[model samples]
Target chain A: MTLLHTIYLIAITAEAMSGAIMGMRRGMDLFGICMLGTVTALGGGTARDILLGHYPVGWIANPEYLSFTIGAAIVTAMIARHMHHLRQIFLLVDGLGLVAFTVIGCGVGLEMEAHPSIVVLAGVITGIFGGLLRDILCNQVPLVMQRELYATVALFTGVFYVGMLWLEVNSSLATLLALGSGFLFRVLAMTFGWKLPDFQGKEIRGLD
Target chain B: MTLLHTIYLIAITAEAMSGAIMGMRRGMDLFGICMLGTVTALGGGTARDILLGHYPVGWIANPEYLSFTIGAAIVTAMIARHMHHLRQIFLLVDGLGLVAFTVIGCGVGLEMEAHPSIVVLAGVITGIFGGLLRDILCNQVPLVMQRELYATVALFTGVFYVGMLWLEVNSSLATLLALGSGFLFRVLAMTFGWKLPDFQGKEIRGLD
Candidate 1:
């Protein structure tokens, strides 16, 4: 398997585990946990494919991905209490997955011959929308919309990768550089508690 | 426009108004209100088309729908407080829209030659997912998943419509019959405060 493909598999597994944890916290049943985990791991790609008119969406074409996500979710659900100690490791893996997802999404957008702007957007969508969907299902405001530089990392990775290709950089090298830089960016942002600005007075009424 | 098409226009407008009101209540800004309204109006079809791998989604294919939704949202945002008096009318139109959306979705599924079950599912998805998505964006458990017989109405409409087609009923007649019956079912359900059964104890912990 290609390096990116390997990372993709690992990332999905991590994403699924995290999603399962969230579902468990919500006291969801087994079916709900599995469904939420699958959506969290694959919803971004599904959304991207649908928007770009890319048919036979990734998981549909490769059903094995479902196995990975569902299996990871079940495993997580069974051992979640013991897994609390792995929080640091989970965060690291999740961050890596975020960046990797961004690069892979950029690859798909490029293959579709989308405009550079759209290509970058596809990447961001693929990177963050899974979590967005998960949060939606959990009945909570999406953290990406209100929290740290999560989406910003995806946006940066996408733009950086697209820019490198535009500059005639080798594709493999560009992917590696983008993933590396983006992961580092995410790590630093988390370590430093970086956050986007929020509306100062959240009660700015009237426009509603 | 055909009868179904005309109803769709009115339905989307009504749906958008309802969505805008929800966003306004959430203290969302003008842009958020418009977006929420649009998503609430169009999200179901967008979701159905994506799942079925149908290209050029409804809104993408006919950008005019966006104008209808956005225009309705903007108007709603401006006069929302006064809209409380129109609750009964709004619910009536929303119910009609729900049934129309189901029939319309079944038509697309039939066009694609999906299995009857999948066709019915598509109809249900197209009928309810808009509201599901709206509730998600507003950060709440989807009422369709928790409350009255809303999704059941879509399910009933789809099955009724598909069964008529199977019996070789004329298409227009089937559409009218399905719409009429589904709308009636919804109205009666509402008038009588019918609801789906919820789990006896919402605190069924441990599956987590």
Candidate 2:
């Protein structure tokens, strides 16, 4: 429990920093950068809670999380010059954060007694939607929608956790298993360039 | 009430057509086109309901509305070739839809008896977010944030509605006043190229 909490905080911080990089890339103002970072850090959970009608929204209930993201964004902006050199480490943390989010989301769904399918969907939503929302707000192609096994990794984590719980596995053991497998899968996908086939359904052409 | 319902359907249809055009511009597949249309048509209401913790989300409780968006998208695709000539008509319809959505959203906020500020935010969310979500999905800069008086119109409608209610105005009368004012303002803005000044706050630059 302690480990997961720690990882979740680290994950949000890593995601916020990534958001800051995106903000700098776009030459956004400080407020814009912080806004993007906060959204990136909290978007997925917000989506999940809203979908489940979970009230008070996480950050709204816990201002500290919001503050953490804002502080992280500012710090990232300050250290923007050195970001290039930190990419590798940053990516690793991001991978861990992705796994942490998946596990946490899965837990939330399970707590709600949602159907297995809904639980899996919830996990994937929490794990990936933050980055997707961030990308959308930044006016960039959402990375998850187009490339990599990102959401797939979260799906795997969710499925495994659900299976473990169904088998009456120890709760902590199930969490660790789900987290480890998802984190490793994403890391491997990143290292080996794994990708889901792109959706290339042709769009209709305009008359003009 | 019947008028509002009729206008709501038309609003979704118009918004759906706009979504289809955006999808065509992006070269999306049938499924992608439908997804964009549905989100663009209903995104605002979903955001408003979710933010307020309104249960069941509107579309989930009303599958007919979802079907309407899907049907509209398919129809739009079929008539894509004629869209160039229909732009003006579509723009007018879109303006009307914008007003309809704002009025409906403001009504929702009033029903909830939310704080005046939150009610205004709710109305704006319901009117503007659908288009914003569509723009984000299409990987374009959201038009509302930078240019035009798009969100401003929604804001005006919300404020106007609130003022009317504060003065003990009849609910239906308040709706008409807000809808008329917002629709006219938007049409004028579109015709006259009226715009809010751009935000050009400085962005931090990287060393390298």
Candidate 3:
């Protein structure tokens, strides 16, 4: 397979795994698990297409991706007994998905002749929007709001990739460099349990 | 104010109220409450614009809208006790937002010269996406997932609006008719607790 196709496959696998992990944490039923997996797999691309004004949506156009996600969900559920230790795997997989998506998003935005600021925004959206959608579906505060440098890391990586492009770096090399940076940053953060400072909530007493 | 501007104001107010409700339900503090209100207020238009490749994003460009939403959020929070019996009011306000946004979305999509199907999709995105965003931020399964017929109703209204335009109907009349139809459907569903059938989840029992 071509490099891009290979990357897509890896991304899809990571997404499905992330979905399974999210599902297990939520104690969702098999159907809910599949729903999460599909969202994780296709949500970012769908959002990207919508933003680019690409009609019908990528997932709707390619039903196979949905089927693959569903199949992975089933496999995850069946192995739930032995998958108790999959949380670490889920975090890694989510990181991989984030890196791959950010690269592809920036590339697509550039292809569409979008402004630099908008392209960076698109990369961030493509990297994190699916996770946001998955979290929403599973009824959890998204990782973005959970005091992590999740989105900030993605944002930096996106700008890094865009800067490389502007500096005349080869596209392939730029993508590889950007993905590696994002992945390393995330892995280090996960290992060290790093987090953003919490925003002190309001002092008002009767708000709730 | 012109009728369109008046309706837009009403939509913004409705969305802010919805956001406050979501925040309160989640026990969020003032910042979270205000953020939720803004999400509810501008989310649909933002989603539609992003999807349609409309740049600068409507609310982001018109900072006044964001300020208005924040102002509404504060007002709603201050009067939380008086709005305790807010279910009926919430439903009606939500309905109005849906209708006004639907008209605005369709009008913009048409102007952008998108395909009919794409136009309708954009309209629905404008109508219902804010609530979806609010539900996601509040860590819920979004009101639509309950099979509340929310998106379907928006789709019907969008299609009807587009069809009327195709038939050379007056823009004002078309907007009014579409809004009325969507609002009526939403109100009926809310009043009668109408719902669609849930999807049958796949069984995943055996093969790990």
For candidate 1, lDDT tens digit of each residue in B1-208? 2999999999999999898777777665555566678888999999899889887678756767878998998888667767777888888999999999999999889989999999999999999999998888878778898888899999999999999999999989999999999999999999999998878675777665
* TM-scores for every predicted model: 0.61, 0.61, 0.60
Q: Model 3 chain A: which ten-residue window has the lowest total lDDT?
A: A199-208
Instruction: Candidate 1: give the clashing pairs.
Output: none
Cα-based lDDT for every prediction: 0.88, 0.83, 0.76
Models ranked on DockQ: 2, 3, 1
lDDT of 3: 0.76
Regions of model 3 farther than 4 Å from truth: A1-4, A24-27, A60-63, A202-208, B1-38, B47-132, B140-208
Model 1 stretches with alpha carbons more than 4 Å out? A1-46, A55-139, A143-208, B202-208
Q: In every candidate, how many clashes are there? A: 0, 0, 1
Q: What's the distance in Å from true for residue A192, model 3?
A: 2.5
DockQ of each: 0.11, 0.16, 0.12
Which order, best to worst by lDDT? 1, 2, 3
Q: Which lDDT tens digits does candidate 2 get at residues B1-208? A: 8887898999899888788777766665554566578889999999899888787678756657877998998887777766778777778788878878887887788788889998888989999899999888877778789888889888888899889989999988888888889899999998899998865556756578
Q: Model 2 chain A: which ten-residue window has the lowest total lDDT? A: A199-208
Predicted candidate 3 versus true structure: per-residue lDDT over B129-195, tens digit per residue: 8888887797667776677778888888899999998999998888888888888998898778788
